[model samples]
Target: MPITRWIRGAKLSFARLPIRGGAPSEPAYIYRDPWKGDAEQGARIVSGRFLFERQEYSFPSGRWDQGTWPEPAQEWLHSFCWLRDLRALGSDEARLTARALVSHWLSYPPTDLLVKNASVTGARLAAWIANHEFALASADRRIQQKFMERLLQEGRTIAAFLPLPAQGWKGLKALKGLLAVALAIPEQTGFMSRFLRYLPAEIERLILADGMVAERSPEAQFQAARELTEMSIMFRTAHSSVPPILETSLDKVCPVLRAMRHGDGALAVFNGSRELYSSVIDEVLAQGARQKLLAPSMSQGLFTRLALGKALLIMDNGPPAAEGFDKRAHAGTLSFEFSYQRHRLFVNCGSAEVGAWNKALRASPAHTVLVADGLSSSDFNAEGRVVRRPAHVMCEHQTDGTAHWLETSHDGYYPPLGLKWTRNLYLGGEGEDLRGQEIVEGERATPFALRFHIHPDVTVIRDDEDIILKVGGMVWRFRQKGGQINLENDIYVARGRVEKTQQIVVESIQYKISSEDNKLQESDEASSKDSLSENKEKKKFSQTVTWLLERIPE
Candidate 1:
């Protein structure tokens, strides 16, 4: 049942093979004019203009016909605007267009289908191949034979698409799928063995000892996980055993997948990806659950049904895994996604719609921790370049059965003045309820601004002794008494900006300090200058401040 149901009696059709014969010729069905201003128009545009246009296609690396970039491939593989709008015209037109699109896709052969933008090509190709394989089940033998022939050819190409010396972990994922397909084909075992030899080296580089993917985007991790899972399935279905290298790959995939789920069935939209592949994860988790493969309490979430469970800790710790591919990795460093009891408690403010990184929706304030005046730790313009580094200064995480703690620091505002900033969170308790604390430390007693970005739909209020957040008919409250902070709710903040506030409370040993160090630094530096007038002008410059939050136990 994990497979999608197919429509019956849908005979697969194709135009006669183009030949140098003396026979009457007709316009191929793929070239038929589409209805103007109708859904079919889009298909016509794609097929006749985009897909078939000679000028738009280029054989990159002598293998695949690709657009100048990834846009075209993304359009062909995922766009539904054409099919959905065309379906409104009538089932016949919709079906015809759909069939044509499918046929067009199958006809191209894998060598000419993948785009040159290697960053997402592997994942995209894997998805296309997986879906196409399903579609082929209903295809006629002729179509199947043709498809299989192309697959075999592509399988050989994939076998030869060895990892590049400079591509780093990027090629590992694509190669993994390429190897899977190659191994599944009966005659390609020789190529498969050679490909398998390189996997352990790649695994050592891409996967951390703790099972996190090195680049740290939850979306990337999910994509990698899906590919790994699919490869595993492909080999298993063929009654073939996984290569030894896969053991390390699976070790990374399993735990990270568990950590990336939110309390809801959906995943935390991190990095450039937004669409939730819940069904895919569900299927994988189901397999794990059946085999009793999941660690107890490690991946507890509503989406963790006996099958197809969700991830528990989603972290966009850094940019895309592959160095040059992800243009949308955010400036927020060491940012993370967490869900407990199905409630999402922490998040980065998602990226805005305007700008170059617009397609990278994960960079917004709604999905990160860099708040007011605290610029991202890394430069956005330097993305995918050799100079890129995490925007965060430092980050660390530790977990023990019932307790977990995470800490992060950054100097996003340090260049203007000399200062550093740090933030920490600690969560502990047993069973139904949990207690937690946050502390912000810095080099200067600057007023730090922390803005906790929450879903606009949620209600937030400060009670006499506690901070309360309510969402979807559920409530959680954090009480501050005797310098202690206690809470039980899905408290999630995409961004928290804190600055100098007049409010201060003292209890036990915890102290609250908020000051504008940026202004103070400017003032001091100005005082040291001989030009008082110039110093005054400089002092007028705004100052950057840091905030500190300490939790006290009752």
Candidate 2:
């Protein structure tokens, strides 16, 4: 490792050493937890178990520190959510449970490395600071002092080991924790200026200009926005002027975040995103920071959106998240999700919490895209690391008259299958008619399959060469040419559970061109037009698939 990295590691390691001596001061300011809590969930925690992400796990009562917990549960433990949830109950039982758990963990601090995660540490520090008033409200002086000592130790450790460059979400979260510490106690006041200086730079680095997280997860984007909002409140409460960058970041982010939503108000599950409940989106936008400007057709985000009339289509036109950020990136390049008014029509299989299902859900076949050779466009290893990815991708959007056109192509298949895929989408002026053209170019014959995952609410009816999708009062006809269509069973992972769903698959059709047309040609516009005519003897084979979706009148 480089000296700089080694030094950072050493500093972090040194900071984790138990500090028995320290005093915890009551926070001068407390920022509200933007995410609402559930008292029922808090009841479960008091029972010595955690029900997180719809997955439940139990630990022996009062022996919580003796065993390793399942994920989400483990992460939840480190997140200090018991304290946050305790506020929801505001009951004696909840307070006792919270005190017991905090005392247990503080007494027998887990050796698990996840406890030291930058984001978790930051989040826990902030959570403790925000709920200190309640957690330290105990009449017992010993209990209060122990809680304060733990908070001071955690805050000091987090300050010493704040995430470095390339930390992505983890670094931003660490900054939030440091800022919390700075706002809470008088001794850590210096962190305020440093946090203010780093806040803008971190936002600019992690949040793209189009207001998407660099990781490209809609869920992650929302988390960043929420933290930034809380930070803004913290600064205001501390009588420190909010930074212009903080406000400006929210301005750019809120609208794009809004655009990513479906009519149902849930976020699109593109890259490792899960559908979160509550009117959180409304709460974020209600601050008046959101601009009501029309959504852009293409963003720096992995998804490209085109809203025409009552129809909204979000297409994945960008590559997977970069290497370090690929933990949550899905191999669904060129996949898409579509919604009309209040109903979702076409959708990608939302992300899962964990296990084999989660890995399978991230594959290309689980999305609305063409899967070549039964493999994902971007391959992944057993550990969810991206083993392969597209080398180049090109996407463009144009408007002609009242019609909107979006064209995108990727070379993800070129490396293994020697095939290139391009898709063109045209939305009619009234958004009643949607047309698409898919072209595959390759040197040799290769089996290809086009998949279109549908939302569970949409029912499909076969009509010979056409497929009709009915959702309540609306109807959409899916027609295709030159490929066989089949409806296959699928799964939709969303809102914390998987539901049985269906997908439309179009099998590949082979086509061949004469040797005269086989040679690679220049990309000049003039040559491209005449190239077809130049190969007169070329017995043209259908190398394209055309499909259309037209709204049927009531």
TM-score of each: 0.59, 0.90
Total clashing pairs in model 2: 0
Q: What Cα-based lDDT does every candidate model obtain?
A: 0.43, 0.75
Q: Candidate 2, after superposition: displacement of residue 510 in Å?
A: 3.1
Candidate 1, 123-183: lDDT as tens digits: 4334434444223345566555554454444444444444433343456655654554454
Error of 1 at 518 (Å): 16
RMSD of every candidate to native, in Å, equals 12.6, 4.8
Off by over 4 Å in 2: 17-21, 60-72, 163-165, 288-298, 514-542
Model 2 lDDT tens row, 27-135: 5666666556778878888776777656777744443345556565676677785677777977988877776766666667656676567677778778877766666
